[model samples]
Target chain A: MDTQGTFRQTVEPALVRRLQRGELAAFETIYRRFERAAWTLALRLTGRADVAQEVLQDAMLKAFERARQFRGDAPFAAWLRKLVVNEALMQLRHDRLHVIELFDETHADDDAPAPWAHADSATLDRALNRLPDAARAVLWLYHVEGYTHLEIAEQFGRSTSFSKSQLARATKRLRELLAPQAEDTPCTIGSTTTA
Target chain B: MHDRLDHHRMTGDASLAAALRALPASTPARDAWPELASRIRRRRVVRKAVWFTLPAAFAAGMALTLAWPHLQRSTASPAPVRVAMQSSSHATPPAAPDIDALQASSQQWQAWVQTLDRDGAPLDGRQLTQAVALQDRIGLVDLQLSAARNPSTTVGLWQQRITLLQQLGLLHLQPYLVATQRPASHDHLISM
Candidate 1:
């Protein structure tokens, strides 16, 4: 995860090799290396440092306990990230309501034409905040973790269809919120990133 | 504008992830590493002692019981002669201070056992009973160990406790841990 300097060029590959050979030092190094990455993800998702700490610690301990099961087909970081996300979601579920609902019944927007959108960063942030917790979680998992809908569904304890619906709805809401700032050419469909 | 949206999502997500990753790591209530390793060593020692002394203890007790009848039949005429023979043949080595220490420790253990009977929680259900038994057995070993004065005995008891804890799935209780944010990955994509 932390592929900085010598870790990427030398330490990482060596550690992986040692891990494959079942060496203790390798395990220690790996723990130390990715500890920060794991902690960060947990903190952001949980929105509390204390909860994040708990989740991260739990994830690492589990990883070590199940280290033997690590089939190297996927990078260790990916597996570790999945574990962290699951932990974060579990914490969230415990803290709040299970199913989240988001709707604006007053404004159907069916008759109105889609407007240009180029909202300020603050406005976009608020729009993201306005999304339901479940949708926010899906967006983070997809846009951040880069997980597929099926993976998100599996990890987040929802159906794949639910995951797809959440993402589509989130993107749609974001577009509408930022519509006032749209450029003359307009924000291209399926080109949310390319200006 | 489109590029800006993409940038917004990317940076916003990263910053959020970065914030999330900053959470501190917590130490589990019970660290399984030292406990596990120590338990493994203790079990090995216990097994070794059990392997050696069990058969011998059984055989010695049986031999004494079988000879009891024969000794009773010869008791009248040769009682003093038999006593002298027994004294010579069965006399153990001189009492060592370690044995005395062991005895004292066993007495302490007896007190602890009495306390458990008096104050320890009643383990009602079957599983609970087994858990209690596992812990109690460990305590019993400590008691036996104080009187036994054999270092090996202590090791054996420790090992047995470890085995029980392992079987109970207590060792794997803390499976997950903490870490920092991971960079977003780009690989396979699925649409459903």
Candidate 2:
């Protein structure tokens, strides 16, 4: 239902002005409003709740400091999201935790249905969390965050093919992990579910 | 056949992407506000401390710069002046031509420094340290000029003093200059 657009509309100009004026209450309001989304993005990127919490706090503080730089041209949520993403990337780099696997050149059989096609969101989330840091990050950025391959490549300091390959590998691995369970379950009645 | 299969794969991938996008943002396990608020408070306090401390340091540096020459002059025996006068007895004393000028120049710079000390209430820590070091150098140069043995040496030292004074004046006037150039905007608070 155009959730992102609706979320952007919720942040009133008056509220932003209050935040710009260094009002703690205004900042707190912003924090409560977006903290969950920020935390989720962080968790997806970092794959650890502890690290995600740290990234969330750091990014929120940075947002508070740079609030005056918010030109009001972009959605406040988008701006905050950028900060969170940057912070999560920085934290990952600082921790030296990036684990990029070489993309396997062999393609998976295209006719095979994706096991995760009908998996519950929670199950999908757990499977995503199992991915290597780099694969998960690329997957999240490309799919969930709506960043293009070029954008993901730029963010990761890699080539577009690198992003493409990482996404492929991630999706392949996720499907493999879910396929066995899907085959065992009696609910696998149709070949229509692909993802 | 390959084209149709690729299309089917694309559709499946698109559905997967949609599902991923639709996943709800999970709530953090604990409330992050109390800690976040404390961090913001701590940062504000640190910023305020820096703001207050920096100007005070700049003022102290200005004071030291202004008072340094006088302190040095008071401590030294007039032996250097006596020696210079005795050494150049055949010619006009090197000190006679430049001492008054030097003292006046020093006083002028001192006045400028005092004005800055009064006004430089917003100088940051780095700027204050720079001002202090510049002032100390000026005092050292003044001492060197006062001890010059020849007219040539005195002229060089006088030139050095003028240059140093020019720099010190610029350094001292920095805060006022910056303030005038950029009328305080709300954006300034954001940087801190």
| Predictions: Cα RMSD each | 14.2, 10.2
lDDT of 2 by residue, A40-67 (tens): 8898899888999999998898798889
Interface RMSD of 1: 12.3
Q: Candidate 1 lDDT, tens digit per residue, A1-195? A: 534311122335556667656565666676666655566566445645567666766666546545666666766666666677776777676675275676543432332333212433334444455566677677667765667898878666669988877776655665566565454333333312111
The 10 consecutive residues of candidate 1 chain B with the worst lDDT sum are B171-180
Q: What would the per-residue lDDT of candidate 1 be over residues B37-72, giving only the tens digit for each residue?
A: 443344444444444433543443354346435433
Superposition TM-score, candidate 2 onto the true structure: 0.66
Q: Which stretches of candidate 2 lie over 4 Å from their true place?
A: A1-9, A185-195, B62-192
Model 2, B1-192: lDDT tens per residue? 989998988887887788787666677888999999998886675466446545754564575467546644543447678666657786644445344555555566566556556654456788788878887887898798778775545655655665676676667656544533422332222221
Residue pairs in collision within model 2 = A117-A195
lDDT of 2 at A188: 39
Worst 10 residues of 2 chain B by lDDT: B183-192
Clashes of 1: 41
